[model samples]
Target: MPFFVYGTLRPGEHNHDLFLRARTRSEEPGRMRGLVLYEGPGYPYAVEEPGGAVSGDIVTALPETYRELLAALDELEEYAPGDPRNLYERVARDAVRADGATVVRAWVYVAAPAVAARLRAEGRPIEDGDWRGPGDSRTHRRG
Candidate 1:
């Protein structure tokens, strides 16, 4: 199965090493639409938006490998699977890479509506280029 990873989970980031440790493959840069990237206190989240987009990477992992990846990511995000307090959920999404090819089957961590609302109420709205991998310092503009 393919998973779409944004934030620190992207390649070359701190969490990327964990994903690599999980033995995932077929990694490639990708973008998902209908989500806005927000910068929280220490990380980023993708809030669902009708016409927004979030850039990330596409990775293919075996179903069994999801267990390890989930554990590592949940730890990093301070979230637990099936926990209501968590702000992200694994969901199927479609993504297109810079090359314009469509990846129709991928799983991505999407921000929960309640979490997004709470963040907005706290005055942290989604910002362009809010999501970045390790060594990615170039400011990304919304397209």
Candidate 2:
């Protein structure tokens, strides 16, 4: 499955070059609905919410690197299957291509239920659901 990445994994961000540069088959602009973005330490977290949407990139990994990539990403997100202390939960969701012509099921690491609850009570959301924010120089938009 492709991954819908909205934070450090997006192009030009710190983790992109380190983890995805040569491991992906393709990467393109995409959007996932029903989620909101929250600021994390030097990163961002997507928390599920009604009427919310997030901008990101849909990354398809090369067949040869898929399993390795998945493991690496899980580690990066600090996700472990069925773990109670998880910060993020890897869930599959539908994401639309930038042109809105295609929709694909992709993996999205969203805040765990406990984390989401705490974030709802105290976290700062990126109102527009974009991690890059306006005029931020760290990332560039691409289709």
Candidate 3:
């Protein structure tokens, strides 16, 4: 199965190597539509939004490793299955290659609307809907 990662899980970010690198069989740049991104404390959160798009990568994992991969990412994202207070919710969405050549169903972590709104009110909303990573200063406070 393929999973779309838009934040820290992207390659070279702190969580990628530990969570998705070896676990995934392959990776390619991708983008997801109708989602807005907000700058979280240490990561960015994605939420549904019309006319929005998020840039990221699609990571393909072996079927046997899919469960483990999802588990690790869920833990890293503070998302426990069926938990009411999950910081992020894991959901399947359509992912398109960066070139817009193809689209595939891929799991994605999205913050609930209320949570995202709260975060945006307190911090900042990634207006461009792209999240590089925490270590990249280029992603924040542009002014």
**lDDT agreement of model 2 with the native:** 0.92
- For model 3, which pairs clash? none
Which ranges of candidate 3 are over 4 A from the true structure?
120-123, 133-143
Candidate 2 residue lDDT tens string, 1-143: 99999988999888999899889989999999999998887788899998999999999999999999999999999999999999999999999999997999999999999999999999988888888867874753332
lDDT of 3 by residue, 1-143 (tens): 59998877888777788887667788999899988887777777888778889888899997778898888888888888788788888898899987898999999999965686686578577776777635673353242
Which candidate wins on TM-score? 2
Q: Candidates' lDDT values, in order?
A: 0.70, 0.92, 0.81
User: How well is each residue in 6-119 modelled by candidate 1, as lDDT tens digits?
Assistant: 777777666678655556857888888888877765667787778888778888766777778666666666566688887787777788876877656777787776887875
TM-score, candidate number 1: 0.76
Prediction 3 global C-alpha lDDT: 0.81
Query: Sorted on TM-score, highest at the top, how do the candidates line up?
Result: 2, 3, 1
Residue pairs in clash, model 2: none
User: In terms of TM-score, which candidate is stronger, 2 or 3?
Assistant: 2
Looking at candidate 1, what is the lDDT of residue 98? 64
